[model samples]
Target: METFADLVRALDTNTKTNAKVAALADYFRSASDSDKVWTIAILSHRRPPRPVNTRLLRQWAAELAGIQPWLFEESYHIVGDLAETIALIVPPDPQNETPLGTLSDYLNAFADLKQQSEAQKKAYVFKHWPGMTYYQRFVFTKLFTGGFRIGISQKLMTRALSQATGIDEEILAYRLMGTWDPTSVSFKALVLEPQLEEQYSKPYPFYLAYPLEEAPEKLGPPSQWVMEHKWDGIRAQLIFRKKTLFIWSRGEELVTEQYPEFQVLADVLPEGTVLDGELLPFPGGRVGSFKDLQKRLGRKKVSRRLLDETPVILRAYDVLEWEGADLRNKPFHYRNQILNTLLEQLHDSGQRYPLDGSPALEIANWESAALERERSREKHSEGLMLKRKDAPYRVGRKKGDWWKWKVDPFTIDAVLTYAMRGHGRRTNLFTDYTFALWDENKSGERELVTFAKAYSGLTDAELRQIDAWIKKNTLERFGPVRSVTPHHVFEIAFEGIAFSKRHKSGVATRFPRILRWRKDKSPEEANSLSDLKLLIP
Candidate 1:
């Protein structure tokens, strides 16, 4: 636990990627194999169900620390993190021995708390908190709360592990994908062992593209890039190997049973065939909006009505593996050609594969490509994906080879209606804001109706200024949130808009953020709800 805590502190303090990788590599080489496995599990968001809830932890902590509950709550708000708050309040015992528990040891013990009584849980926490130092307590509390997020990226972690174990990073990344119980799988078998049959079900690390901020001409000639519509749907991998089908999301979740519509592909696609594509709700021979796809997401079991209503098709863009051969090392154009040919052959053979090849747009040059990108929203696509024709499909995000040239976001002028304190470093500042559009009630009077909440896109200076204004202009307090006087107007930018019954404004906007402070406009000049509804495609 101490070693793991030190590693966490080191990772938090280091800003450079190489330094972080070096620190993690050292820990990977020195820590026990079991601890290393647990570290990987925690880093990859595979932590076990939280053994204790925040409310219970707060109560127990306040009682044990000899502080009033109000004081503890106030301290928690100031600290902005529950783990750090508890760590600070709890004093260490002088007579206690140093904790020698490994990361696995503590995690396993916490997992056992699921069956224990409340008194037993309190006794267990009380027994351990005093003995540990602040750093150990912080890590322990984070694991207990299941909020153990750090500054480590999966790529960096994989790189560090590769450095420590002398394994290929790409191979290590692929091995780390898919669901595996950390408690049951040893580090040797999980990372160091020879590839097992389980590799058949594992999905490769997804290749992500950086957003194209520059003009399309900056990427050179259109002939050098393969242009495909950037479909606003789930990026996924379809794998058929060893007579079984697996569908993995870009987040590495194995969602094989979620969408059984693609099960027929397993029977038709040759063994060991793998495809990288978008799982789009392509009903009525057209790609549906993201809202349509959301209807079937996260279902443990898909119903017949859902299958009929929001049918999905894997719009394959690239083939990673074909007939047991790894095709990722092949040039993308070659791989895409093979994929198109395979799909065409499958269709001509009367195999009803619910799959479609992503069609490349016919653009003569950069100007034509830019014109095509402008029509992305018309096709319900976010933008165009430009991939180098000769580039290999590399693991993780790499620049210069692939880029997503997205259409400009929908922008609207709106009024700030509410403010809330942010977490982490901005805990003292009202950095989060809820913007609203003008709406008319039955009485025919205009009122600012809350529409979207934005936490980013404001500079530090602007954030502090707004925080001060919010403090002076607060109308009412609703716990941590404050209803602020709607004197400020700002331009809100979003990716898409959809009519929603769940929201008070009868609308929801995707990825809303502050574009800029529209101080020149009055509150009454802000856009209205009716105008917002016009954006719903």
Candidate 2:
């Protein structure tokens, strides 16, 4: 536990990726195999099902600390974190020769806490509290509270592990993917063991694109690039391995069960075929708005009506694997040749469904391509994807080879109606704001109606100025939320808009951010709800 706590502290203090990787590598070297597995699980968002409730921890903490509950609550708010506040307030363990426990020991003991009675829990906490060091107590409290965010990502962990074990980072990444239970698998089997060639549903890391900042002419001839519409949908990989179909999101979540419509592709796509594409919601052969797909995102099970409403379409942009061979290292044109051939084979076999292959743009030059990019939104595309014809599909974000030339975002002036304090670092500041547009009811007058909530895109100085203004202009307070006088209007920029029945404004905007403070406009001068609805595609 002490070693784990020390590692956590070291990780938190370090900002550089290399330094953090070194610290993780060092911990992996000394820690027991079991402890290492648990650490991986915890950092990968697989924390043990919280054995203790938050209320119990707070009550027990305040009771043991000899402080009022109100005092503890105040401290918690000021600190902006529950776990850290309890760690700070609690008295240190007694000065004695009590040896600390191992990481596995702590995990095992916490599971026992669930079965114990309230009095037994208090007794157990008291017994354990006095034996642990300060760092151990802090980590223990974090376990009790349920979130141990220490600035480490799963990607970073895999990179560090690759360094420690002399394994290829890509192989290590694939091994660590999916829902692997740490408690069931040993560290050696999970990491060091040789994997089966046909692991079946394993996904290759996604190749990402950087936004094109310069003029398109700088890239030379248009013939050098394979241009395709970047559809506004979920980035997914369709895998047909071992005579089965598996759909994985860009985040590596297995979403095969959620969208059952894609299962038919198993019969069409041959074995050992893998496609990197966008999972678009297309109804009546036309692209559905992003708002239509949000209804099915986190559902454990999708309904029949939803399947009919938003039929899933796989827009195959790139093919990573074909005919049981890894074609990621091949040039873009070669891969597309195979991809087009596969699509044609499926079509002629009478097994073709809604899966569509992307075609290269017919633009003659960079200037013409730019004009085509401007028409992206009209065609329900987020942007234009310009991939080098000779480039290979590499892992993660690499510069120069691929670029997403997205259209300018839709912007509108909206008044700030409500303000709320942000979490973590900006907890003391009113950084989050709910903006609204004037909506005319059956009557002649227009009323302010909530539209979008934006927390980012404002500079530090602008945020502080707004925070001060929010404090002075607050009209009413509802707990953490405050109704501010709607005098300030800000230009809100968004990617797309869609009609929504859930929102009061009857429209929802995607990725709304503060473009700039529109001090020139009043609340009355801001765009109306009807105007916002007009932008819905």
Candidate 3:
């Protein structure tokens, strides 16, 4: 626990990526094998189920610290993080202190927590708190809650592992796929001695594109690039291996059951064919709106009526595997040809298979490409994607080959009506804010109706300025949220808009971000609810 605490401190304090990778690599090289497995599990969001609820932990911590429950509550609001607050308030007991147990020992001990009485659980928790340092306790409590979000990406994790084990990062990434399980298999077999059968269901890391920095024509002649519409749908990989159809989301989830309609692919596609594509809820040939597709998501099982109403199709963009050969190393034009042939097969099938080819954007120059991007809204696509015809598919977000040229987001000026303190270093500052649009009440007075909430796209300096404004203009306090004077106008931008019954304004916006602080405008000058309604299409 002490060593792990040091690792966390090093990781948390360092701002440089190299320093973080070094700290993680050092810990991976030196930590116990069992501890290493647990660390990997926790960092990768694979923690065990929470053994105890938070209310009891707070009560017990307050008693151990000899502080009143209200005092703990006050500190909790100010600190805004339970683990940090308890770690700060808990008193040290040097005389009664003992060496902290290993992480494996703690996890094994927690297995018996459900069987223990409330008093037994309290005693068991209190037994371990006193012996550990504050940071160690913070980590332990956070693990118990199972909400561990550190800054490490899978790419960085693989890089650190590569440094520690003398393995290439790319191979490590493939081994750490959708179906890789650390609990059931040893780390050695998972990374160093991987079995091909075990990895058959796993998805290769997706190759992402950077947003195009300059105009598309800056790259080269139009003949050198292959362009396609960037569909606003789930980025997924469809696998037909071992006579099974597995659809894996980009997040590494095996969501095969979500769209059982995909099962029909096993009838037409040959074994060992893997195609990368966007999953669109398009029946026949016409594509549905994003909202129509979202209804099919978040369901344990799709109803017959819902499935028929919003049938889905895969717009195949690239072919990763064909027959049995791994053609990822082939050029883009070659893989695209392979994808075309598969789509031809799907078309020949008498039954309407849910698969189609994303047509290439035909452009003579960069200026023409810009005009095509503006037409994305007409087709319900987000933007255009440009890929070099000669580049091989690569892992993760490598910057050279592919680029996304997205349309400018739809924007609206709205009034900031409510504010709240955010967690972490910004806990004392009101960074999270709810925005509202102007609506006319029956009384003939302009009213504010909440429509969207945003907390990002502002610099620290800008946040501090708004935080000061919110503190000075607070009209009422409803717990942590403050109803502030609605004077400040912010230009909110979003990818798309949809009519939603859940929202009070009868609408919802996708990927809302503060485009700019419209300091020049007044609350009355903000956009109207009716104006937002027109954007629902």
State TM-scores per candidate.
Answer: 0.87, 0.86, 0.85
Better structure of 1 and 3 per TM-score? 1
What tens digits encode model 2's per-residue C-alpha lDDT throughout 1-537?
899999988997898999999999999989999899989888778777577788888888898799998789767766777777777888875674467788878787778777888888788777676566666788887876567778898888988888889987767766676667866789998899977732677888899999999988888787888789989899999998888888889976677788888888876777889999998888887878887777778677888998888787888978999879999999999999998888888779875486887776655788778888888988889889999999999999999899988999999999999998877889788899999999877887879999999998899999999999999999997756899998999999999888777888888789989999988887889998888888776
List lDDT for all candidates, in order. 0.89, 0.84, 0.83
Candidate 1 ranges with C-alpha deviation above 4 Å: 30-33, 95-100, 198-210, 214-226, 240-248, 251-258, 283-285, 295-309, 320-336, 349-351, 364-371, 387-402
Tens digits of per-residue lDDT for model 3, 86-193:
888887678756668777666666766867899888888787777668898887777676676667876687799899999877567666654444446567766678
Cα deviation of 488, candidate 3, in Å: 0.7
Q: Best candidate per TM-score, number? A: 1
C-alpha RMSD values across all candidates: 3.3, 3.5, 3.6
Of models 1 and 3, which has the larger lDDT?
Answer: 1
The TM-score, computed over Cα atoms with residue i paired to residue i, of candidate 2 is: 0.86
| Reference-based TM-score, model 1 | 0.87
- Give per-residue CA lDDT, model 1, range 111-207, as digits (tens): 8997899989888888888898899899999999888899787878899999999998767876887668988999998998877645577788889
On a 0 to 100 scale, what is the lDDT of residue 221 in model 3?
89
